[model samples]
Target: MYVLGLGGSNHGFSACLLKDGHLESMIADERITRKKYGVGLGMRLAQGFSRNYCLDMEGICLEEVDKIVGNDLLVPTMYFRLQDKIQLINHHLAHAYSAYYPSGMDECAIIVMDGVGSKRKAGEEYEYESMTLYYAKNGKFDVIKKQYGYNLPGTDYVENSLGIFYAMITDIIGFGEHEEGKTMGLAPYGDKEFYEKIRKYIRYDNHANIEFNSSDIQEMLQLKEDVQAIKNQEEKERICQKIAWAGQQILEEIYVDIARYLQEETQCKNLCIAGGVALNSVANYKIHKKGFYDNIFITPASGDDGTAIGAAYYGYYH
Candidate 1:
């Protein structure tokens, strides 16, 4: 029963090996390639490099593996000779599985939220997943709801996502991309000056209020006052801190709102959370403090790295 899970097709790649349904080893592509998030050229080179590492961890060659699983992204053909040995599932489903299987709970509510995830076709084009909800029982989880981001018409930016809204503010404050943790860390130092202004843009509808949308982002939270041009040392720092605080506040408000709604709807006492946004310790703590669930489990590797674990679990169990 050797199952290998591979994740990080779009961002960072990781491999997780399971022997008889137990994790044997795992490694991320960025760990060996020194490439952050699998960015730039020759992604197959990095993925193949990571594949070898996991193979070595189990003291076995690729052919000896019984099964392999991955998320929505394509697995490099160089890594596996037979496509039949590999299976793929939705990005958010992988995220949910990663949280629930390890939570040691037979049933729980699963939530996945990230800046952007695997694309799905909508109308004439594709839209990326932003948030999702799932319910698990007897070691199997089913997606209950999914939220997608839509183009803001004539702009490259996609709106209607809480995760994107937070990440946007993080980038506007000059943190950029994976530096969203910095935004969360700086939130406490900021006052609620802009909190109300940002709240107006984010709204939701649907079961458990899972439908998240940014009513308007062209204003982009009234970002007309650029933080980059402020020359005053104290003034620049003050404005940035305030921006972080406001975004964090809005993030928690909506996060808890969804949690509360799910608690009432599912009546599930256990909660499992994963995805890039689940990395927010501040918002996570706020959810825990509110006592919406009897027990809550959050993966340490909540980002794409953990999706490998989820893929492996999904493959092994199926």
Candidate 2:
């Protein structure tokens, strides 16, 4: 059976074609359109998900596909071509699946942490998910914990998120999207003591979920604006480096804590991690060194693009 998987189109999208449980092709949207993240489409467009390119690469039309799996909303009327053989996967759950299935483990503990996920209604209001923990065994998953934040819809900047906090610090240090690696590079040069400055403004729940107050929001802006006023270039760079160190250190601490909690709860020795935050090599190394699990798997394409793989697996198996 031919299965078409679509992901991203909102934040770095991609398309994948699966033929009888094998990957035929996977193409990133940015590679096709020359536009980063295929922005401004806002989850609607025929060309957004790169379905045409995916179909063409497989030497078949959309009708040839037996099933369609997706974690995003794009071109609904276009779905009529395939009938109702569609599966919509949840945002964070897609991340977890992307990690666990690729890990090649029979059973594992999964964690998904990112800036935002599909918005869900909470009482009278809606919020996006920031972190989710799962236990995967026997081809099934159980959501053990989830952390939702009041992330302002349509924007990446907001409080109450470690992922967003890192993004904010990256932006404050004069970096843009896809340039977070530069900030991570600066981490080793600065002192770990600076992390206390970042940590003071937030608290955590028993699940290691972060809760940032108004001061945390102000801190990034203050660092951004205040640093420019410095007279010496050395002083300015030092401050930026310090902020980068603090952000990276704080992220590593929480990730380790989460790993500890998962190990304690699941007693599963295999670990799989995904979502945008999993892209941090330094933090991943820290988690590895802490030795909470015997085997650790981190999806190389941990962002939204990797969800395509997860969606296809879901379509084929479930």
In TM-score terms, which candidate is top? 1
Best by lDDT: 1
Residue 102's lDDT in candidate 2: 67
Give the local distance difference test score of model 2. 0.78
Tens digit per residue, CA lDDT, model 1, 1-318: 888888775566778889999988888878887888766546365337667898897789988988888887544643455466778888888888888887889989988988777777789877887888888899866777777777666654565578778877887687867788999999989998877876766765534443334446666634735667678989888888988999899888888878887777788989999998899998999999999999999988799889989988998899
Kindly report which residue stretches of model 2 are placed more than 4 angstroms away from their true locations once superposed. Answer: 40-45, 73-86, 152-155
Q: How far is 130's C-alpha from truth in model 2 (Å)?
A: 0.2
Error of 2 at 309 (Å): 0.9
Quote each prediction's TM-score. 0.90, 0.89
Number of clashing pairs per prediction, in order: 2, 1
Model 1 alpha-carbon drift over 4 Å, by segment? 44-47, 74-84, 152-157, 205-215, 221-225
